[model samples]
Target: MNTKTPAGTEQITVSNITIDIVRKDIKNIHLAVYPPMGRVRIAAPFLVKDDAIRLFAISKLSWIRRQQRQFAGQERLPPREYKERESHYYQGKRYLLHIVEAEGWPKVILKNKTWIELYVRPGTTLEKRHALMTRWYRTQLKKQIPALIEKWEQIMDVQVNGWQVRQMKTRWGSCNPDQKKIRLNLELVKKPASCLEYIIVHEMVHLLERHHNEVFLAYMDRFLPHWRQLKAELNKLPVRHEEWGY
Candidate 1:
């Protein structure tokens, strides 16, 4: 926790504890406890009073402790830079990157059924290389989305009106039951195919159960028993480096 008092809100600190009060574009105060350690965070609307926020945190102390414990057991991957011999996951398979330089635009191709074709200059900066690779990933996801939607529609008996992929900063996927649409993070293409399938199934189940209550978990377990493992692995993997919103 890092306490910072912005212009609108006030900050408070207690020993190792730090709290930041800032304005946000939301209706409620959201408190979070992140992993690898029991770091606490609170986000309150600009108009929320300091006393009210303090009371909320005090009331949720037990819940926050439980969240910290969950995070403590979860694994976190180190930061990555697009470098030679770097490992990447695709559809539950790990592939070593083989960078090759060419005269034309960069292109990726599978090589020897063991490695990946990442056509880029050796001198290319990690950021640019990552961008190009991410773009290709989005393309691959686009090619697969339609078939996946159809495959799942029959298996889960749920119809999707539309689906789209984007560079989401935080969550892997989101579902809108009213519109029968699901938006998936393009980064999911980098993970195992089973992970994507789990997400698809998870979102589709939301069509029947709107919230993550007992019914939702039961439906998920009935449809995808190994979903919990996939979710745990997904959380351990490195995510895109971008600002996230709750």
Candidate 2:
């Protein structure tokens, strides 16, 4: 029996692990464990039976627990107050923030590779400061992405239509294979360039294979042999602190 809610989502409990199921027009079942907390979700075809979904979840139980444990052990940075002397990250290096009050427009600059100088007018609120820093991160990430995309396009034989950087709570990046466009998390600016390149390659591979099946893994292995290491490195880094919403 399937217990479904009004929102068209169902929950199945197997081995005390609850899995959220959403029926979609997709061809195959897609299981995912989301971050911040290990929320297990499955996107199954609308015609699939409840028992089959339950059995599939059962088979992947060990993988699900491993992912949950990883999220539990993952480091999370404390909430940012956007104040002076606060530690910030750029290109995987820690830098202390130096707030400068001035009459001119707000701007961000790196000084001596040890400090992130934030220039803002007096009485700037925390929200404004955060917005300014986010903009700067977006700008810096955008500047580096196109070149990486171009580099991978030739190696992988795929052309990306467009890409954008946005703040995402649960995902580092996503791809729309149909549109040939990808959206990367703005928080990636805090990680190393290699991690950024890994994500770009990962998304581009989606253009070749829409699913995370054997074909996709084969493409990843062929294009970036050390991608798994880069992925592990990215996952081990400190994630930004944010209030999660369902």
Best by lDDT: 2
Q: Which tens-of-lDDT digit does each residue in 17-117 have in candidate 1?
A: 45555556556777665444555677677687777887777777778777667765654444567666777766656788888876667777767657887
Please report, as a residue range, the 10-residue window in candidate 2 with the lowest summed lDDT: 237-246
lDDT agreement with native, every candidate: 0.72, 0.87
User: Whole-model lDDT, candidate 1?
Assistant: 0.72
Query: Per-residue lDDT of 110-140 in model 2, one digit per residue for the tens?
Result: 8878999999999999999999998999899
TM-score for candidate 1, please give it: 0.66
Clash number for each model: 3, 0
In terms of lDDT, the poorest run of 10 residues in model 1 is 237-246
Model 1 ranges off by over 4 Å: 1-80, 121-127, 238-246
